[model samples]
Target chain A: MDNYPYAEQTDNELVRLSLSDPNQFLYLSKRYEDKLLRYITRISKFSRDEAEDVLQEVFIKTYYNLNGFDPDLKFSSWIYRIAHNETISAIRKKVARPTVSLDSEDLKNFTDSFDLSRDLDKSFDRKLINQALSKLDDKYHEVLVLRFLDEKDYVEIADILKKPVSTVGNLILRGKKLFKEEYNKLIINKNTK
Target chain B: MKNKNISQIVLERIKGEKIKPISRRIFYIKKVLFWTVVTLSLIIGSFIFSLILSGLFNNDWDLYDRFGFNFIMKTLPYFWLGSFLIFTILGEYYYRKTLLGHRLRYVIVIGFYMISTIIFGSIFYFVGIGDVLEKSFIDISPVYRNIILNRINFWSQPEEGLLSGIVTKIGNEEIEVKDSNGLIWSVNINGASNRNQVNLFVDEKIKITGDIIDDSLFVADEFRSW
Candidate 1:
């Protein structure tokens, strides 16, 4: 047991070993900490502390349900799914805080795909983008965050949201339309004021 | 609660609770059992629906003696129809809980149950299984017979229109008949133009379609023994 390098192991291997030696579970948790923290903040607009609280619960639930995890699913997707649900539950308990912080890198990556033809890299700042994002319904907002900021594909978003892939695609398209409409309206209001 | 490290907190929580993942075999076994129940419910539900349809289609709609179209509508076997709807909803619920079912859109899931019901219903009706189930349900359950199924008893009620039973006495113009409900009626065949076809013999089970003139008197229009 001393000779085995648990740190170098794959997630699946770590899961198997964690059953025998529970301490081996640490590696799996360590792998997703930063990503999950960012995910919670992005989805729920939670403060750093609130996101940490939700992250802790997510990890705890994951450990408890480890045996129930289907081996056929990717470990990353499963963990993200748990994180997604926990964040939603936490938000449901409290009135949602405004969630508007667009990562410039993410915006750059998805600008072309979203058909925001303007050179968003030069013109759009975080505050305006976040304001427009906040105007969307919760469902539309959630999908936009997952698709653009999280950079998840339709299948992964489907897995996390527990919806059909086709539904995820439809949500993104609708979200994009709403996002553009809201953003344009904001710009018009600002000019008149 | 002071822990800044996520992994350490999770490990501590698991150690405190002594939590372990459930065995994979148990999960698979439960899934299989759930699927089996869904399939059986689908089959039984479809068969019941077919029975209701069969009863409706096999009836003599033209027998409008006393109980006209309104009588037929009132006795349209809604008990089986209600049961079919209930089971279809349950089947859809169970299907949605499955792994593959979770991936399907709502329309597709609903469409699956609708298609399954039609296909299985046709098979059940074609093989006479639906009729057998309908007859057995009425024969076996008194609760069903007296409550829900009894509404269809209009088809057997002499007062409502049609009655079937044994011919206890045969006269030249009228016959004394004992209906399935064990009520006796003096059926008048003299007025029927098809009186020659209204042949009655003693101790024979027969169906007499006509109008009830009084509590004990029924005017017969048609009679058949099968």
Candidate 2:
């Protein structure tokens, strides 16, 4: 395993190799850990420890079910789906803890595009955006995060959520509509105060 | 450092756990077999449902004018329709489990089923599988036949000019029948034009179409085994 160039291997190649050489699975785990951990935290609002526990379970489950993974799908989308399922199950066990911790760099990019976009109010800032997101239902919130923050396309989002691409598009559309409405309501309340 | 540590933890968990993957070929074969069974059952169920509908409409609906809506509804096969609905619901479940079915929109899924049922129903009717399936069920299980087919025995009516039942007593002039509704009807087969064809026997089910002489007696103008 040490002599082989695991870093240069594609995800599919890594998966195929990992089946025979179990130690080669480490490279796959290292590849997805950061991205999946961040995703778990963002989606479920889990603490670092809770997210890590869920992430560990996700990877372990992924390893066991590696044969079941459809090779036609993107590896990232498939792994994210397992993470999404684990996070949802964890949330069911423990009440969702909505933490407002956006990646500053990602937030900057979002704000820049949000300012140019017509769906959201231009006057909104990160704090107001977070408040609106918290107000939205879990379904809308998950779609919005996967779309803008994770930057997954419609098909990728559909694979992760196990829904139709059209449904993902509709959810994003509805999410934007609801986010704007919620943000405006918050602005009104703040002004009255 | 923390990220690598969690990755190691995950790796350790995988190592400790039993991670035997089922052979992909076997997994897919099982899925295909399960889907095939579901599809075949759905086709048969839809065919049977179409037969019931075809049988109902094949009759002279002019009887509806005399019998009214309640009689028509009561005579319609509810059991067959219920089976059709059950199979349709199961078909939706298996359909959504497929790769293409998962990717389809809800509206498209529903539209697909509606179109499929229409196509299958028509093919079953035109191919005559509909009547064959219905008859086969009746022949295979008399208990099932008595319970399901007997409910919509539209042949059992003397007041509206059709009566059918098992022959309880075959007399020299009159044949006694235990009607579907359990009434003993005396059918006057003597001197009828089809009296020669009215070969009567005890315990054999038969249909008689004629004028009702009274509550318990019918003047048989036509007679045949039910």
Worst 10 residues of 1 chain A by lDDT: A117-126
lDDT of 1 by residue, B25-139 (tens): 8878878877987898788878886887676765655554545777677667777778887888778778876655656687887788878887889788889987787768767
Model 2 C-alpha lDDT per residue in residues A65-168, reported as the tens digit of each score:
88777777899998998998999999988876554457676577556645524555456466877787888888888888888878898999998898988988
TM-score of each: 0.84, 0.85
lDDT of each: 0.75, 0.75
Cα TM-score of candidate 2: 0.85
**What are the per-candidate TM-scores when only chain A is compared?**
0.86, 0.89
What DockQ does model 1 achieve? 0.48
Total backbone clashes of candidate 1, pairs 3 or more residues apart or in separate chains:
0
Candidate 1, CAPRI quality class derived from DockQ: acceptable
lDDT of 1 at A99: 78
Candidate 2 CAPRI grade: medium
> Which digits, one per residue and each the tens of the lDDT, describe model 1 over residues A80-190?
989988888899898775475556665665565565657222355456667888878888888888788778888778777778788988999899988888777777777
